[model samples]
Target: MSAKIAVKGLKKGFITDQGLLQVVNGISFDVADGEFVAFVGPSGCGKTTLMNIIAGFDPPDEGTVKVDGASRSGPSAKGILISQHGSVFPWLTVQQNLMFGLNGHAPSNKEQLADHYADLVGLKGFEMSYPHELSGGMLKRAELARALVVKPEILYMDEPFSALDALLSLRMRKEFLRILAEERHTVVLITHDVEEAIHLADRIFVLSARPAHIKATFAVPFEHPRRLSSPEAQGLKESILRELGV
Candidate 1:
């Protein structure tokens, strides 16, 4: 498959009280079209930094990020980021939140589109509910709906389920997988959870600690609704954990 997104010699740093803090160093990778790729690493690694550059939320001090063969310098409508910090607007209802990004569409079309995605994410009856009325999982569904309602070509997720309780996180992952099966989009996820990465990604990239670079890459050979406890899955998980030095 051709690359839908490409990175080469990517480096980023920051000025701190102690002097220059290098976060990403000479990192490079490609995400194939409609592929679900995850980056797993130790805390303080540059996974999020690498994601931000690819999403056009930040610029790299060196190297390049190209989407569809074009260098990305700023955020594009074709991509949407569902950040770890959460993007739901407290003041808006689920319907309103989904409608927020449909500004270019006609009013009637926007309403229908919002309704479609809201239902798609299992928030059908919660259309008029505000963010505060929703549970952690529901809020995540709302955020997912809002992003998908825009029909972005690529969905960038950063620790999207990190805040949910363990059981809820598992449920959401299953729901997310179902949704992905129905709606195909290139997805790049950043997560510290090894099992979550294995469960959701087509390919997994493990990064080194700060001044991060790719340490290893693994292909998840299992099909969807993977059995994590199966011997093969457990073996792959062990390999990944070993790479993470867990």
Candidate 2:
């Protein structure tokens, strides 16, 4: 499989009151086209920083990040980053939010597209509803609808389900996997939830505590709608927990 995204010796740090604080230290990895990959690490381990650098939100101090074999110095038009907290316009109705990025299209065409994604994301009747009126899961589905409406080639999700309650997060994870299977967009997810990573990722990359680097990579062998209770899945979780030392 050809790599859709590649990073080599990527390094990033920030100016701190104490001094320069190195966060991502020589982190490197490749994401294959149409692949679902997860980065799992402790909190504040630069997982988000690494994600920001790859999505072109921040510049790397060293090395390179390439998408579709082209090095990127800034955010690519083909990529979209979904924040840990869902990104949606609080002021706009669900339909309007979906149409926000489709400005160049005809109004009728944009409406049609918004309706299509609204249905896909299970928000059909809630088109006129505002964000505050929705539940946590509904907000996420609405955000997904907004992102997918743009037809991005790659989706960079930063702990997308982190804000949801445990049960809601699990349900959303399943829903997300089903949607991704149909959409087949390459995904790079930054998450600290072990079970979430195990359930959704084709491969899981473990990063060490601060000055994060890839500590280990585990391939999830079971099929989607994975059995968290099954021995195989549980064992994989155990291995990952050992790597995390928690």
TM-score of each model, in listed order: 0.97, 0.97
In lDDT terms, how accurate is model 2?
Answer: 0.92
Q: Which tens-of-lDDT digit does each residue in 1-246 have in candidate 1?
A: 558999899999999999999999998899999999999999999888888988999999999998999898999888999998899899999999999988779898988999999898889999999999998889999998998988889999999999999898898899889988988999999999999999999999999999999999999999988998999889998999899888
lDDT of 2 by residue, 1-246 (tens): 558999999999999999999999998899998888999999999988999999999999999999989999999988999987678999999999999998689999999999999998888899999999999889999998898899999999999889889998987888788888888898899999999999998999999999999999999999877889999999999999999997
The true-versus-predicted C-alpha distance at residue 7 of model 1, in Å, is 0.6
Residue pairs with backbone overlap in model 1: none
Please report, in order, the local distance difference test score of every candidate based on alpha carbons: 0.92, 0.92
Model 2 ranges with Cα > 4 A deviation = none
What TM-score, to 2 decimals, does candidate 1 have?
Answer: 0.97
Q: Which 10-residue span in candidate 1 carries the lowest summed lDDT?
A: 1-10
Q: What is the lDDT of residue 123 in candidate 2?
A: 89
